[model samples]
Target: MLTKEAFNALLKTLEEPPENIKFFFATTEPQKVLPTIISRCQRFELKRISNELIIEKLSAISKDLEREIEKDALYQISNFSEGSLRDAQSLLDQIFCYSDGKITLEYVNNALGFIDPDFFFELDNQISKANTSFAFEFVNKVHSLGKDLSYIIEELIEHFKNLLIIKFNSKTSKFLSETILKKYVLSSALYQEEELFYILETLTQATILHKNYFKKIHLETVMLKIIKSKNVLSLDILVKKVN
Candidate 1:
């Protein structure tokens, strides 16, 4: 960012640039980078690398190095990397060292302290059955495993959001493998649309409020609230507690 006067001077030069002059500006948020500056430039927005591409690249790397890796493991690595090739490579590097020439889901979860989708599936099952005691036991097991409580909350929020998406747009599951898609479809049946939305809202707020000490307790309390609320939750009440 620049002062108005400085930007004006730069604008003047850009409006009538010297021959062969070139300027490059990059940002994650281009909309905030002054509209006047944008009007003078040709824009090219870079799209994120698709999960399919990332997974393919990871698979190639693992095979070329003679390391056995599962397809689901590749997808998980791709998902966590968030479309960053450098990050994906770094994750693969760590995974390679941790794996004994063969990478499995359990190996990845244990090595990285990653909360597996199985955890969410089990939790969802218990919640569907209105088994609050099981949810508590699950949370205790997660805590004992030294998993990141905050991360789990965020992941759970994403999981339910996916369920809501699948609930409304059933065709969206076609993007996922049949196995993963089946899980989401089954999970979606356990909640009404508004119930999932209420949950997503509460968990989001919990992320901000419970970022301090005793996060494990905070996460457990919120999970219990969510699982126990078989009916639609009072949004007002959930917000009040989170706030």
Candidate 2:
């Protein structure tokens, strides 16, 4: 944002700068900067930090600080940060203050008022199976438990992504074991890539539309959409035509 006064004051110095003085300007939003200033300065772009790298650094920092944060907790912070190392570290700092050293995924969830990941997994499983009855029942439970619908939608997107990974990978995990991974691998077969993409898009769009309040009617509609998604393809079962 270039105010007229600021720009005018800088214009003289930039146009006839002293040899000893170097002016460096930095902004997260380069588009807001004046085009004239942009043309005059040497520009550098900083890319987003990767989650794994951030997690790796957080793990080291936690150990050095004797925090002993769990792996899932770090993963949760990494996922929450979305590639901002500063945000991730800030979240870790919050968790550290809240936990006083011993950090676990459940602790993080409770601290953040977030529901368990397993709830989202159950919801995803029922949806992938097209079990509308169970799906709606689960929603009722969620309502009774008073979980945040917005957060559920956010976590559900991540749940679907994990299932998508199981489709192509054959690795076991310290948390999600070989047996569970194999199960998600089977569940992943129930959905097409396009179907998952559509579900993610729809859920995200629906989530964005909700106000500061929870509406069962809106969630119910999303459940129906999940159950009867138009993008679904029968990949798990084969049907032969009668001759």
Candidate 3:
């Protein structure tokens, strides 16, 4: 039997009058629990650990890993973690595993596996020689890399968001090299800024939908929507158009 069910059974046994018998339930989510069960117990709320404590824990782990933890990386983990020490630790663990413990701003970028500038540039170059088959094949390769379709879409959105930031304020946002994005700037300039904004919004929405449910048809539809809206045509089409 589940522990919860056993606990509930034990509660029944205690319903009458068992002297010196006590039970306690601890949960992050109490609202989902039974109020009747809660009524019988003395409740004690635990204070959440502060951010400074969480950073100290993270710094300790970084020392153990023999890695230099940069401020930007800490900021990324902090932003994504929403003040949960465990979540921040878990994020650091994933990042170190993904990057093999060499932590840097680039390492953070690589851990997330954002779009490669060279690949996008080469993609632009290949437009002339590429065929539609290449685009479908590229999607398959991306799938084989153990990344979910939703994650890939989210990465694309994040990359473009960085680009948009760079476009507006060149000095402040250096997540991407200005040299690499210049090509995209040239290409993106052809379209109205409104269109690019629409594409980003669409990708974000698609990511949300895909994460809610894993549907192959829905994934393909999102990809096709991206291809059409972004003027990518096909893998081949992108190569030729950009070339």
Candidate 4:
């Protein structure tokens, strides 16, 4: 970022640079750059690389290094990298040094301190069963592990969102693996579409409130609310009850 005076001083140099001189500027936020400066330079926009491409690159690197890594591990690295090739490569380097043998998804989760997806699935199951004791104990265990409560909430939101997608249209879930897809298929059966919507809504609201007053109790309270949420009946179910 340049100050107004700095832009003014650079304006002349941009307009008429020395014969062999050229100027190049890069910014993630081009709109923040002065229009006068932008007008004087040719702009290029770069889009984020796709996860498949990132995994392909990582696979090539792993082969070149003579290191064995699971395909699922590579996918996890790509996802955590969030479309940043440099970060993905750096993370791969670190993980490679961390492991003495073949890298697996468990190694990746341990290195990243990410909660296993199974935990979310089990938590959902407990909530569906309205097992408050299990829910509270699970929260305490995760808290004891020093995991961020807010991050857990975010993952829960995404977990239920995936469930909602699976319930609504399983065909659109090509991103998930066959094993995980089977689990989702089973989990989606536990909630109606309307019930999933209500859960998502509640989770979103909890996220907002958690941001304002962050506390473990807030998380536990939200979990209790979710576990005890009233079941929402679909139109067909309602009509059947009336009949």
Best-fitting candidate, scored by lDDT? 4
How many residue pairs of model 4 clash at the backbone? Answer: 0
What TM-score do all the candidates reach, one by one?
Answer: 0.75, 0.75, 0.48, 0.85
Tell me the tens digit of each residue's lDDT in model 4 across 131-193: 877768877978898987877778788788999999989988755656777888888888877
Candidate 3 clash pair list: 126-239, 127-239, 127-240, 128-239, 128-240, 130-236
Q: Give the runs in model 3 whose Cα sits over 4 Å from its true position.
A: 1-4, 10-24, 41-57, 60-66, 79-82, 90-101, 105-141, 154-197, 204-224, 227-243
Off by over 4 Å in 2: 1-13, 16-19, 141-148, 168-190, 204-208, 211-214, 229-243
Per-residue C-alpha lDDT of model 1 across residues 1-243, encoded as one tens digit per residue: 566688788888998989997988777777666779889899998887888888888888987998898777777777778888778889999989865767886776676677778788888788778787875787788788887777877778878888998999878653355577788888889887777877888788888634579876787788887887675557765686699
Question: What is the clash count of model 2?
Answer: 0
lDDT of 3: 0.60
Model 2 error, position 20 (Å): 4.0
> Which segments of candidate 4 are over 4 A away from where they belong?
1-10, 209-214, 230-243
Model 1, position 8: C-alpha lDDT score: 84
Cα lDDT tens digits, model 2, 4-64, are 6798788878989999998988777888777777788898998988767888999999988
Question: Per-prediction RMSD in angstroms?
Answer: 6.0, 4.4, 8.8, 2.7
TM-score of 2: 0.75
Ranking by lDDT: 4, 1, 2, 3
- Cα lDDT listed for each candidate: 0.79, 0.72, 0.60, 0.82
Span of 10 residues, lowest total lDDT, candidate 2 = 234-243
